[model samples]
Target: MDCCSPSRRQALLWAGVAAAPLAFAAAEPGAAAAAMPKDALLVTDAEVVTVTDSSVVITWFTGSATQTDRYGAPAPVPADTELLLGEPGNPGSTRTVYHDTAPTAFHHAEVHGLDPGRTYAFTARSAGQDAQQSTLQFPGTGGSSDAPGVFTTLQPPPGRYLFTLALSNDLHMGEQTAGIITGNWPPAFQQDPGLPPYPEVMLEALLDDLRKPDRGAEVLLVAGDLTSEAKPGDVARVRQLLDGWGTLGTDYFVARGNHDRPHVGADYAACTPIPYATDHHDCWGDVFPYPRQTLSVHQVGGLRIVGLDTTTLDAAGGTLDDGQLADLAAELRRDKDRPTLLFGHHPVTYESAVTTAAGPAFDLDQTKARQLEALYHRTPGVFLHHSGHTHRNKRTFMEESQSVEFLEVAATKEYPGGCSLVRVFTGGYQVNFYKTRADLARQWSQRTRGEYYGIWPHYTLGTIADRNHTVVRDLSGLTALRPR
Candidate 1:
């Protein structure tokens, strides 16, 4: 299937760019400018990552690192990250905050305790000194900045509790390799004999965490890639693990992933693919509730939870057949007032700090992505779109077409292993990430940092502070369903 037109995507999407550089003049050898080390504090790529009514995360790179990939890749030099933040000109109210010490050239920090809908000025103090005037300011931007780079806080989510859910994805059960796709090979990735395989150990740990009482999640959702392959044994193991949490379809929900797609093989001759659905593989739709249960819905409080079978019938990429799309449209059209939570295995829009060929292919085809977007906007109650193919934690809000937050979560079977707890309230909702406390799970997360190559810490645990922040949304349209 064809991806969306480049012109369409470009016209619809908005993103932040690296901070503009400042012009400098030649100075005498004895001048402070000449005296500063060439490697002295320099901040680049500083832009907003996450924003809410009370908190904002500004991430940037320092020194001279030739960082390529967005995740796992660290900055080149060690610099102390600091933020001088306050309302435009209130020097007395300004606070100086610093980031933790890591060898990474990247610096990210979230500042809390601000009023909603207010403009604030922020600048970086990286390396050993405050940012010099090498940053250019945008023209006519609101809020004043000494060096340029400021943001306005957004309205927080509603202030009442309605429901909660747990989400995890891409466990990749029955896999023998660790970090092979990590661009660079690390020795520790080779699972030493006698260890009860990384996937098993990590998954067990994940299950233990999500079941904790404090989580209080009424529903558990596995976004996709339930197994490394759609083999019978792997499928059975995943079902068994899920049953440990609760009865499937009642307490938890799942979607099929590309890795879980049926493949041509002679393991057994009795299995045949279903029409318009399961033609390529011998597993999945036959053994599990896919395609057959492709369009399933569950209700919690006043919300409608919808799951989509985005897995392709023949390719590794994802797509929704005419039947699936039509069903989704009918469901949304049935009740426009009920808020919805949609989960799937593929992302609607590719989210990446750096562009790569894999971005588009890694997500649902562009044409389908747009179709889903239009559907969501037309329905309006679809507030949250959860997906898990990229194996990273990033949240994006669609402001123009409609107000929906799209979250991409990390793999539960590797580094940054864990799940997200979504707390919904009468006022709004908050989605927070938890690094599963399972000892083996924690160990595996660190061990697999090599999987992300050297960029692991930069994207996983080290970035946890920003990854675990809150989201406050507008829920006025969602009237609670009283006892009927």
Candidate 2:
């Protein structure tokens, strides 16, 4: 259970802090003095939320120069927003521009007619002012080359798109605050007084976006952490909201996370109790019970989707009991060639663990993690492992399971709030992260962007490639679950 030394985690955390603040003024000479003019509308946190072969959604925040929020950060201000895009390095190229004349603080623009597999240079402007000194440059580009911005469109998926699967996690329902990371110096973010809970706003936004025909997600996989603390009311409320979205067992599925594990308390006395911890009541279990067993498989057309419960009753780190591991191995052996997507709460790669301050607790225990990795190594059918605990967007590949991508997504209730759409095709598949675009969702996301010294984006907004990309595999085996 003691997977990694705390000394190593502390060392890595310090190293990350030292190297990550390069975006701050203290790390960059003249950055503080070169701050935007007080009167000029400031545009910052511009990022490509979702990128397909033909389109991409760009979102950013425009702050009011004359006003501030209760947190003492610049408040959102109305401004004209536009997207300037063209072929990378080709100023003379016929530029394509999309304008949202609505004059709002949280800007969301969708650009279409982009050529497949081509790289484009682009930037978002507000009131004709650019974020020239933005600490968080657009997702991909950085340094002097940020001008005109840069991102490569995903190459088309290998074949016809068979179905779309929405991937998201860490809703953290019932949590009253956001960005509560370590000490008091870095304050947490909270909803303004009297406002609906921020988590509710975000969850509704995510469901609305997924419901749109444009997104066309036939199934949804919420990796884990459905509740903030496994509170009974919160657990039931989460289920009620999700049931409004889709049927739990067929249309959508969820896994357990550390936060959703049962705790011993009087409030949960009426809830189901776990055998592993008999004194603890399982509120999460009572609301959304596992279908057949803790580890179960569902077939979508020809693709095999395995939902694994990785949370442990006793600790924050995750593990698979001997029985569950044996069940997974047997299921994989049932159809060795079937394309499989396994999702759980905790990440299963060593690299994902060290990157966060939580270290071992941020991931599955090394013993079970390696066990899962080795199982995937022998199972060519397993192509992806989706998880959400680190609350960041990171794509990792391990030598033992080179074919399976270990993906960690950011929380859906905070900055960069959104989900990824997995487009499964005959030849391969693509994963595109889409930040929720609803009005309140975008506004709340912008507010939370100020978390962690305004360097939050530096850590959470991963590279453009990490958010969107295509992979070629022999998925000819997968048939359409629903028509596109």
Stretches of model 2 off by over 4 angstroms after superposition: 1-38, 94-96, 133-148, 182-185, 291-293
- For all predictions, the C-alpha RMSD in Å is 10.0, 5.2
The TM-score values for the models, in the order shown, are: 0.65, 0.89
RMSD in Å for model 2 = 5.2
Q: What are the runs in model 1 whose C-alpha is more than 4 Å off?
A: 1-158, 182-188, 268-272, 276-279, 350-357, 457-466, 474-484
Q: What's the lDDT of the predicted structure labeled candidate 2?
A: 0.77
**Model 2 Cα lDDT, one tens digit per residue, 122-148:** 877877776443544333311122233
Question: How many Å off is the CA of 66 in candidate 1?
Answer: 26
lDDT of each: 0.62, 0.77
